[model samples]
Target: MKTLDFWFDTVSPYAYLAFERLPQALEGISYSVRYRPLLFGALLKHWGQLGPAEFEPKRAWTLRQVHWQARELGVELALPAQHPFNPLALQRLALACGDVDGLPNRRVVEALFHHVWRGGGADASDPARLQALQAELRPALDPQGGEVKQRLRALTEEAIALGLFGVPTIAFEGKLFWGLDALPMLRAAMLGDAWFDGPWNEVARPQPGVRRR
Candidate 1:
């Protein structure tokens, strides 16, 4: 079976949508997904770019777009009380639920996503709600421990090393498919479509005519 590394950050509404739609997108494919939760803020800092929510106009556009996309895709999504909230706690908790190889429990992943995306405008970073989630998870590792924190850092570093600048990216066969819209392309690649062997590589060969300062 093929293994796909799914990199996500709960702070992203698109990631939540992708997580919910992934199973249906990959139907009939023999593949296993390894959920890798990382801090979206860290990625933004590392790449020297601001997140959509950090930019005023883009934030508004992103909010509207995600809600519209969710409706079109028939997936449930509700923005939390705050955008760009701290996701460190959730990421650590997800790591604590992992096995020895650090493969997080899919159920726990889903629960965390629901906490953020389906909380009906509740504060995802609220201490009480987080504690409740921790109690519900009964994680194998200590979510508040140093080891979990280090592991989260390691994972974020690994993602950066792999050249990932965004959440909801699926890494398959050394190629990265980014965004919820790329699911169809991922499916095509998984099915070994020959178009990837031709235009996929050829398309990247074009250089930009104008440089932005």
Candidate 2:
């Protein structure tokens, strides 16, 4: 069986969508997923890029796209009251739910995603709501503890080292399939499709003829 590292940030609508669609996307594949929570803002910073929500026009388009995608995928998704809110607390909470390996269980990950996506335009960072979620989780570790904070940081650093620049990335067989749209390709890769043997590797070798300033 293959192990898929599902790297995500709770702040990403695409991540929530991907999480909801993942099971159906890989129905017959023999693989286990490790839920990894990381800071998406940190990733954007590292890549010297702005998040989709950081730009006005892009933010509008992104919101529309994600909502359309949710409906198409038959998943429930509501944009939070705010876009690109700090996800540090959510990341820490997820790490606090980890057992020895610092990887949260699927249940914990799912609960977090639902908390952010299911509430109808709710404030994801609201203290009262977070308190209720904490009570519900009853995590074995303290979400506010230094250990959990350090773990979150370490995971983000590790993600950067692995060349990950975005959330909802699935790392399998040493290759990364990024975003919700990439799920079909991911499924194809898992099935050992012959196209990956040549075209996949060949596609990356093309040299750019022009440079943007």
Tens-digit lDDT track for model 2 on 117-176? 997889999999999999999898999999898988999999999999998999998999
Worst 10 residues of 2 by lDDT: 97-106
**What C-alpha lDDT do the candidate models reach, one value each?**
0.93, 0.92
- List candidate 2 segments past 4 Å from native: none
Pairs that clash in candidate 2: none
Residue-by-residue lDDT tens digits, candidate 1, 1-213: 999999999999999999999999999999998999999898999988899999899999999999999999998888999997999899999999997688586798999999999998899999999999999988998988988999999999999999999989999999999999999999999999998888988989989999764
Model 1 residue 182 CA deviation in Å: 0.2
Residue 62 Cα positional deviation in candidate 2, in Å, after optimal superposition: 0.6
**Best candidate, lDDT:** 1
Off by over 4 Å in 1: none
Q: Candidate 1: deviation at residue 148, Å? A: 0.7
